[model samples]
Target: MGLQHTAFMEEEVRRGLDPKLARRFLALVWAQRGLVTLSVVLLFLFRLCAVATPYITKLAVDRYMNRPDLPVGDRLSGIQWLAVLTLAVLTVKIFTHYFETVVTQVVGQRIMHDLRLRVFNHLQTLSLSYFSRNPVGRLMTRVTSDIQALNEMFSSGIVALLGDLFMLGGVIAVMFSLDWRLTLATFAIVPLLLGASQVFRTLQRQVHRVSRAKIARLNAYLSENLAGMKIVQLFRREAENRRRFEGYGLDLYRTHMKANLYASVFFPFVDVMRAAGVALVVWYGGGRVVQEHISLGTLIVFISYIDLFFSPLRELAEKYNVLLSAMAAAEKIFGVLDEKAEVLDPERPEPLPDIRGGVEFRSVTFAYEPGLDVLHDISFTVRPGEMIALVGATGSGKTSIINLLCRFWDVRLGQVLVDGTDVRRVTQRDLRRRIAIVLQDVFLFTGTVADNIAMGNREKPRASIEGAARAVHADAFIRALPGAYDAHVSERGSTFSAGQRQLVSFARAMAADPRIIILDEATSNIDTETELLIQDAMRTLLAGRTSIVIAHRLSTIKRADRILVLHHGRLVEQGTHAELLAAKGMYARLHELQFEDEAGARGIVQAGEPSDRA
Candidate 1:
């Protein structure tokens, strides 16, 4: 059993030294090189001083026992010298411990700080597609829980393991120096202790892995359900959600219980073994002392050494669990760090200067997944200052076209050109800076209303922010609030209505002063009153900029310079509202289907069928 445990530990250590883990661990330590080195040095010095204390005690015991007839002056002097030596060693031990703790904490915090920032920055650089595929809770776990686990490994686990190793070595050396036979006798149970540690560590690691996974799943479930609490409540799913949550909670509890069980059993087993070792040492060493083969001091020292040896063994057993957890966390964190950004700027890219907003898609084709094209080989052009409306059924590639034009994803075939220059030739930052997007699913950060509006233009003056808000007609409502521009917006802007958030987003886009603007279902969620307000804002914002409006409301597109109707990733018709209605094709059918109850369709027909509009 002892040999098996040793071999298993050796294997685990070998696995831990794998190139990837080694690099990550070493990098974390190297980040605080000065503190790490100091901690190690202090730990080594403290172990040396601790090892010498028992020897000093042994010397005093032997001198007192062997020199009963010594002169009083010599005896007193000898006692004083021993006392001084013991005091010195104890003082050094105390200071060493203090410094070790200080250094370890410093190193741990620094490494954690760097790791967290790297994770956050990488998350920001990842494409939207990656975010769409991963849940927010899962990502949060990597940043918070995983980094915290590593902090524990560095702050306590590493120091404990190192201190135990040094102490164990020192104790073994002193024991052998005192009496080899007694030392061998004391070590007879070492294999058994090692075996038990290995078994406990392996079981504990498995339990911890299960526990962490369960916790991650629970977090994900909680985040999802909370975000959609309204839907859940409306559907009367309280009991069902509770039942599901209970299952996840129970899974975590079971895993934690299993880990505790392993720990509980291992400690008691180790204590029993320790007791047996102490008995063997005292019985054997006591006999040797009676036979005068060894002094009483030697027996006492042997007993002390026995205790010292087991102390490290016990501590090592405990630290093994922590080490395993840290290793697991390191694997997860490095996996995130190793993820390369799929969307990166071109090397030696040309800088975009003064964009004219002439966007041309030349036979562009795209797909979120391979062999599944969302936008087929479609081509179109939007001249400067032209208002183009894209009308299509859901999944007709209208949004995909805007996405391609924005360089969110590059075209799989042909190219997207801005002012006859391939978008791929310039940096995404430069390209995006020239274009402003107002999405239907408006997102607002947690901050004051002014901060949210100025997000797109950080250097914009306060007056500019207020002016933009006024243009979108958001100023009236914003000022009506308690804090006006300073009113706090909660996360996701839940405090405000959907139409209000949309209007705020529009104001934000207008603040950026981009050459090209995209309104993606911008008015779809707004009421008629708000839509009319937004229509006026849109006309003002689009006056001198190229605009692409994706609208589900047919009435919104009737006044566009030209309307393109898409069906199944293909352009089925391109004409003004009146011309399309006259053509009596897909557009006319779609218009009648959507606006049959409204008088806007008749007003559109009454307007002259202008060719330039198409």
Candidate 2:
């Protein structure tokens, strides 16, 4: 399932141009019509100036420089004015080109900015299953390199291709008007130029498409290894991982070189063809000049126009690479945008009425994959203000239950109701606002302690943030730090210990002040002393709120109002701790295992005992 995106990327690359996708890209341009219009106007003016320069040169040579029929003074005066006119035309062309480049660049940046934001916002709306299936590196390529490719096309490829076409047309028109026979003779090499372009286009499509896909795979691989670098080092897999990375890097290098090889051959082939056209003009048009059948100025103009014609042809060949890459990138980016969110809000929603912290699972069933149910016919209820503990082995659907409760996932069968309303009846935003979950692996953003505590809500007063931290007993260590609440926290809060990070997570949950608090193995990783601190903090954090606790430590849940034991996705037992022990069922067996493990190791009876199950 994780490799599905890689396969899709490869397939999309192999596919040829899609008109539907081209139309979509055109629509993006249409959205910024004003900037595009200005760019086009500037480009037209530049092309006009480009066309005028050669004609002015012809006028200088024929009417002013060579025509003895005119007076010597008149010829001198006319030649000087022609030089001035030539300078003015060149100056206007330079300014128009500058403005055109600037406008196109602005359009490209604005479009890329809008597109990146759209992809980001769409990702946020997708269900957790989508993220679980896709790699972060692959998505990063879509938002970064892929969009940048489109920007390159917009900034340089599209407008330049248009300008090149116009320049070619303008040159051909003027040359044909001057001498049709010479224009036709010089254009004899057009067939060879066209043949080279066709072959290069085929090669470019194949190599560039594969190269882009390879880049995406490389990024995904790097992101995976870097994120798990600690595990790699612990397992002594550095040399092995590097070999794997080298393989990826080598694959990308070979693909790019293949594309470069095709370009290298094709570009010089264009130059040779351009030289062939120049030779035809020198041999054919030069003879006509000698026979007095054409002016020397007309022969020179023919040479100049031939250069103008082939120059754009060469540039169009170059810009085609950027165009192909942008097309492939657009397909991938649009694919992401088109992903259908599995969980969507109803067209019309029923609002929750006066939400209390009551929760229920009525015959709920779930599966992360088809035909593989993780939770089957599970039913439970938690009244407002009740603290219930879920006891289960790993893969026994404990976390799945929490996921459903939080609406991170929806049940496949039956209902998960909160405050007597089906969770699907309301927007996810409204539903999750009432629940705050603390997991065993706490995640903290890069910010100050207070910023993390407030969780990006600027409206959260400093007094309130500090009060929440103090409630979780995190204030003691926080105050000991350099800046106290204002201290800088590095990425993922790497500066904090596991226990300290957990304590801050508790503070975050408390700050939200949710009506329902979920502790999903929140204290399992803490040391004995740190656990004692959090155990005291939990009492205050969970007070007056409905709480659900999932833990491997049996002692932590001994004080729970009720305990439910699960095995293999089924509810096998439920009762108070002492009541379940007296019954001697699965719950009693788990308690016995923990009790034996703790007693044998420490020779001390302590409530802080670990269980072998989640």
Candidate 3:
């Protein structure tokens, strides 16, 4: 047990020493280091005054008791001196305590501010893949609760712990000076107190760990439930969800109870040891006083110093738990800071100027993972102002092609060139800015309709935004709304229908006036009426620009200058729709399948023709 506890403490200390986060944490506190030092100095000065008060008290007691018959003038003088010292100490102590509180609060808030901003900025830089895997609740807990725990460590724990250490050292020094033998006897309980504290700290840390884990789980459950409330109601799964939530809630409650139980025991145990220390001090000091080894006044001074000494011991015990909690919080925060960015810009990247959007894929074979190619030895070229349609079934690498084009992920086996320069050679920001994409899943931020449309060009005038919306036929519906362009969109534009959001997305893309446009299943989720509107918008959006359209519907690709039929990550056919139909290949089969479905809906079947097999 002892070995295990030691190892745990060592691990916690090691995690707390992460150099990057440690530097950040130190920088936060370092800004106020001068003020903190002044606060400490003032606190120590107050302790000095406090220490002298007991001596003054001893002198007054000795004078009044042993020298009662002294001259009235001398007694009055002594009493006045003691009163003056008492008042001075009281005044200094009060102001110093106030100063310490103010300084600690300022330092704590500054550190928290820096930490929150740093964490939020780092989170923004992290890849989308990280967010896809981690729960929102867990991330929020790290940002909020974890940082709060560290705040406690800084605002109260560190200051109190330091002051206690100073008081302990001062008391021991004074006690030994007064009477070393009795002082030694009074400190006999030190080892026992230390041992008990270490044991309780270990237990408290374990309890805290369990409690934190349970809380994270509970938070995850709450977030998931809230986000999927509509789905739960639609499927009538409220009872099941309630049961699951109760289980998580109960687990969190039990863990919190256990932690509180451990804390409850820890303080009382320390209090018992404190009581023992006080009893030892009085017993040993009484014997010394009886033997004339120490004067009554001196004994009283020793007792006062002992009381001051134990105050820090008690404080140290209380803050041990906070220290452990801070270490845990720091470990989790540093874990994020330590994660290396998987995709980074090159050290010396060349800039591309006046790009003409002539894209070429030279033997490009790519995969998300090693030894598994999703696009194998694929080669293609798209000249400026060309429209290319990629027609394929589900999981046929169409989206992967778009992902590579946008440089969301780089090709592994070969090079992708834009305007005779390798995409990897140019800055990612410059490459992405030149391209605009309208995806099947249209996302709208919480803002006015005009604002959403103008997202691509925030500096664009309201006239340009309205022009884009009009070109996409979205202006009619938008103007019909309560506030027209100024109407606010709810979260994800839940107020708008799916087709309306897609049209707004189209307008957003059009507003950018990008050199290249990508439509990846952009019209798949829209109705026929909306699709017609988007088609008209696409004609204008794609004019004088390179375009790539990934579509499943055969009707959408009929007008493409060239259609590339992909199968199993390989391009099977490439030609105009008419030319492919004449060839009677995969494109022809898919076309027949779609045409037959239309004919079947019309209650018509051609004689002597086999049913479409796509």
Candidate 4:
């Protein structure tokens, strides 16, 4: 049947990635093994050049720049050679970084694409029940925002963390080699650094988790508001909604603030510790240099190594945030992925091929939720090419029957059979292809009028599309619009009137050319004149097909081959309109009520409800 296309994807993006999903993300990273390996090589090469620069400077200072004892000409050539070597090393650093950025970013972007596709595909496979429970905004968040967190992590997190560790290791090795005593003194502040880092880590995790959930809430709220913006304005809810949104915004703000607060406290803490380490090195190494235990060049290199060592450690901390965020996002993405669609094709599906439409519900039972049956022990049979009408009070399971007929849901007990084959035995795709349903609420996509008429059957020729519209009597009005059949339909076909949209929906169903046609209050929006035009066209439309109609109109129901009256969830009566009136049950009472209701508005003796439907 039809479902509304909502604008409720008005979502707020949060920076979130998953800690639990990290290993799986690593597998994604590892999937691009070649790129990852290249990045590693480049990172190491970059760090090597970085560490070598100071050592080269030290060599130049001790052996060439400081050695005035050599011939003046020789010293000048030596200095020039050292300067050229330093420049070459600097040039290499630039290229290494350039290549590293390109590879890392490409791999990161690819991973993000794959992740979004995975989540979207998973969502597609999920049952309608799953969608009924989850908000569109939340799914939109996972695909758009949560996955974006992984992109940040891929571009910066894991790679940076590894590279920094490698750099830290190299610097530590170089420092210890230069002077063990000085290296030991420099490491005195490391324990304090670790403690502060641990504290920040805890704070960051809590902040990320809270931010993830709060941002999801914000997105859901915003989506709901935007979709209902008309209602909000009509009811003067702007001030109240704004206040509610402000509360959500404040929660999000506090979440970010907590993350930033820890980050703010962390950097200064790290900077202080770095300075302490540098000071320790300067005091200890300077004494050694003064006593002639170590050369001034070695002392200088040791201090340079200290800065190199601490810089990467600081980088790793920032990278940790990205890692945590990515992990959180991955966790959310995987949560959706891990859930299997409750409704799926059977392993050995029976074929539903080239058949006349005859539907039978044999002792069928169903429900939207467990233990609360919406349809109970419902048994009915429609002959091939029969036009059956279902009249019911609210919650009488008419729509549920249509849902079952289409295999939108399986029967909980007994069987719903199409041409004597159990509906559950066939693939849903195949079964639905044989049924065309037009509901009260029609959803029109953005496309040309002809394209909207064709719907997903994109290969349908212009002639076929035009023919479908003509068959539904939609062609005349469609031709009146700008550019006629080629005219563009705005989002949800908003440019068209409700009656026009319904006509297009009729055209779409007509184009499908199914054996079974279901119209659930399909003529509700049409003006009486247009409804008459549709009713005339529908006779031809239903000439060979089995039609199941749920409408309040006496004109529509009176023509049905048989009318089934329902009360609560039971099929309480079944006969023709004349027969049902002769029986004088719920059908007669409803008929009388609808006659009075339409009399006040249309000044016609037609039976139809103005404000309610079963």
Candidate 5:
């Protein structure tokens, strides 16, 4: 996501699973305690049925088969009854397994749903700075793959571990009851098994940690590359990009191979241990049975119990990998949940009802980074219904001023007031609702033209949408499109021309009926014809509303009520367009330079017309 997020992830991998993180994760699951408890109960029932199967077979052999003193009919009857009981046990085991799988999976999915929504909601509350530092793809991984990992743990890893432990416990108890000597023989191999498992876990955890990081980086790279594919093609970077992608893919491949290598050696070692345990049972228990110390049935049961015991051990080793992966995912998810929003509403916010659109910035000094101010002691005021234009060189804090007024970033020093009430004193939602911003780069979601104009405010009636469109001169072109206003908009309004998108953006701002309008380089991308249309529409659109327009083009803001020229984050000049020009200050110089550039551009075009005729 960011350097900080990446560092934290690496630290978590090095530190391994934190019990505190696991507890926090469990707390989320505990919110659905009813379903979780039911799933656990079903698991236990399944285990009980599974354990009974071997014992029923033992009972048939020990009680019925060895009783030769009984009549044939009685013996046959007993055998038949025991067979039916075994079938019944098998039936119950199958049903219990079915129900348990269904319940556990449902719980897993419900938890995923809740967690996904929780993460999404938290994302909404985070400040814009957080998003600036994090990429969309990395954050998406947190919501999608990471949450899926936790779901896998719930469905298979954690639940399976519990079930396996329960099975192992039941098997041990039954084995010891039949013959302590044979049970002790099986116990001898467990220490070796445990040692092997410890080694495997350590190795696998590191692999899993690295593996997760690799996948996340791969996703981020893929996302970034795909988003910029047009540039890549224009630059002919196809070969270079493919090589880089191959490198990422190979890195992931090596990680998986390393994990597989470890598993290959470890699992076979576990099987050898199981075989050794089985061999021990046969050797020691067979002699005991021959000496009449235990029945043949008891010896067979010991062997069956031995298999059951080792089965869990093997399963536990496998589930441990899933557990480690889930732990890492949980840590990352909780990290996001724990991030406090840099901008927050005061516990008791001042009410800002019926805002009258007057804005004031009182000696506002701000910095995106400490000790590096972007805006230095900036002070300005806009009376209601006044249209002021901000003109400056790039990075002279023109857009930063807009950001402060909108409270996108809080001022480090002094107050930004809306209608003389400190903007910070009111909730951001309340303050922002009174302002509408139309930026240079307008972002439109994938939806219909009408939807983009409404911008998720579904309460706007069809008449208002159309009226706003017509007011911004967007209605004419929109009605000419394939489905008219109902035509589909591709991602980021790529389907529309640059001018069309800008017009739609203006319409959107107008549809909001905001008290204050912000047009930051809003007309810079429009052609001359479209610009004239917008300028004509803006006279009517901006009437009786406080508007702040920031543009690089001098001609666009020539008629502003007043012009403020900024130079290196300071207010160098402010006055009516003619007044600034008469004073011969920074505004005059900028205006002259732009006029010369336009003349030079016209000369070049006129010069090229003769070559075309030739």
Candidate 6:
């Protein structure tokens, strides 16, 4: 073997028997049982060819070289036949080996692909709370790096380990039948081989666990920093961010080196044990040949058998280390899949009619984490086609109200009704389809402008897309682009300005054509000129649909049919904008503060100004 050969492994990974995870993993393997069975069978056939070759060599040597009792011509012809048979067996073995690789590789790739999709689909089912607690970098590792480890497990690790066991069995059975005493002598080093293997496996596991943890940590830090790089640069904290990143990078490098150290030590240790086993067979078998107790052919075959048996044992250990990484990866993947969706749809969902846009919150109280209430005893209602505005101090649960209405989070104490139906009773899909939201921080995926506008709804025609853009007054800017509606948008619409992104978002919501519109600070980023265009669209858009607008600007707030002021998560005031303003309460003070902060026009504070003030 090459001195430079090293096993590819991660940190100090501990192999666990997470019983529930094991069963789920086994079920996945069982799904492809037919292909798996055939691959194993081919591996077994290859082992048979390997074991038979040595025995044929023994026969050729004895009959042609040592047995002068037969004619020389006959012995020479027999030797030629043996050589031809040897060539044929090796040819079959090589072909079967190639086919096995093909089958197993395909199986491995297919399994990983399904696992990735399964994880992503399950993620979609989970509530926003799950994502809030977990970071994107950590989840990305589960889908990419972790899945790659499992691919190795399926393609070559576990299957190769099985083949090694079969090969070992064949070698042991054949050797014992050929000569019992020499087999016993060869078995003398078996205990040492087992002992060394155990020690190496323990070391490998420790190294692997360490490596995997560091890699996952590094990924988390990288993803977070990348996303917030703009803020980091804006604050002039580049040095601090770089220092933190360097610490994570250093930790990963240390753990990786430790894993590599163990791997290098393990393969060489196996090689030494292999050498010991071969030496024992040679010493005993040579004595037998000298005494004429066993044929020279038999002695030679025993030596060959020693190589076959020990080689598999060595391979089994290496592949077992790879399997440890797979087991760890499986634990993480299954952990995500097992998490229950905190917000669930009814088993037998109530039928939801086309929404007339009436929304009511009847004594609704909510909290993200238990005992930390963000909203308390909140009750309000919007009649069909009514435009209501929500105004409050920061942390007064204004956003929480929107979350509950959208069913992103269910209210703890009361019913959030769309039309006459409690949101919990209405299926989530049906409920969401009837409402549209345009958020302040727009999230646009990478695609053409038209595709982003239409979002995922595939039934929309180009004309409909254009109409939505025009209604949002976004058609002019979109048409000015190089490819107009077909122009490519970069990540999160970074290619466009803030106003342009908001307009694109408005177009998206309009295309959905929902009965209720939630504009949560949607125009906070628009310039005065663009704000005028949007204000024009707002009048037309909110005409026949119920709308919930969360705004701080006095102008936008005053336009609402009614205003509800939340103070410390409690509804402190509710009535028409003039009525609340005249009452001289929380609404009056909030309106005064807003007027003091901004000049006229749409009355929105510019983007990047204080978004929330308590």
The top-ranked prediction according to TM-score is: 2
Descending-TM-score candidate ranking: 2, 6, 5, 4, 1, 3
lDDT of 3 by residue, 1-614 (tens): 12132111112233322466546666667777887787678767767766767877788877854566998888888888878878887888788878878877777887788888888899877755566556777777778888888899887687777777777777788778888988888778878878877787766777666555556666766777787787999999999989877766776677678777876887787678777777876788888778888888878887777678777777786687676677667777767667655556678999878778898889988877678787888888888888888876666678778878877778888998889888888878888888999876778989899989988467899999999898888999999999999999998888998889988988998888888899754444457677777778777788889998875445557667888877767888898979998999988887786645754443122111111111
Clashing pairs for predicted structure model 1, backbone only: 561-613
Model 1, 314-415: lDDT tens digits are: 888777777777776777677778877666778889979998889898998788888988777888888988888888777788888887888877778989
lDDT-wise, the better of 3 and 6 is: 6
221, model 5: CA deviation in Å? 1.7
Off by over 4 Å in 1: 1-19, 65-67, 71-84, 522-529, 598-614
Candidate 4, superposed: residue stretches over 4 Å from native? 1-20, 522-526, 599-614
For this target, which candidate reaches the highest lDDT against the unseen true structure? 2
Ranking by lDDT: 2, 5, 6, 4, 1, 3
Query: What RMSD, rounded to one decimal, does every model reach?
Result: 6.2, 3.0, 5.8, 4.3, 5.0, 4.6
Superposing every Cα of model 3 onto the true structure, what RMSD results? 5.8
lDDT of 6 by residue, 1-614 (tens): 11122121123344553566667776877888888898899888888899999999999988787899999899999999999999999999999999988888878888888999999999989998888777788789889998898888877787887888888888889888988999988888778778878887777776666666666767877788788878989999889878866876776677678777876887787778778877877787888889988899998888788789878887787787777777888877777888898999999999998879999999998988899888889888999999888877667777888899999988889899988899999889999999888877888999899999899667899999999999979999999999999999999888898888888888998888989999865565557798888777767667788999886556667788998888788999999878986899887776676654674654563212213221
Task: Count the clashes in each prediction.
Answer: 1, 0, 0, 11, 0, 12
Q: Global CA lDDT of candidate 5, please?
A: 0.82
Report the C-alpha displacement of residue 578, candidate 2, in angstroms: 2.1
lDDT of 5 by residue, 1-614 (tens): 23233322233355477889778878878988998888788888889887887887788788888878888898899899999988888888888889889988998999999999999999999987788777777788899999999999889987778899999889888988988888898799889889989999989988888887777777777878888888999999999989977877887799899999999999999989989988998999899989999998898888887778888889898998988999888877888899989888989999998978899989988888789888888898999889898877767788788888888889999899999999889999999888998876778989999999998888989899999999989999999999988899998888788888888988998999999998754454457788777776666668889999875445546657888878777888899978988999888787776644754543111101111001
Tens digits of per-residue lDDT for model 2, 1-614: 12244432334465556788878888888999999999998998899898889899999999989889999999999999999999999999999999998999999999999999999999999998888778888899999999999899888788777888888889889988999999899889999899889889888887778778888888888888887877999999999989977877887788888888998899889989888899989999989999988899999888888778898988887788888888889888998999999888988998875578999999999888889898889999999999998886677778888888888888899999998899999999888888898877778999899999989999999999999999989999999999999999998888899989988989999999899999865454457888788877888889999999885555556778998888888988888888998999988887776655764653222222223121
TM-score for each predicted model, relative to the true structure: 0.90, 0.95, 0.85, 0.92, 0.93, 0.93
Error of 1 at 361 (Å): 1.7
Error of 1 at 594 (Å): 1.6
- Residue runs of model 2 more than 4 Å from their true location after superposition: 1-11, 522-528, 599-614
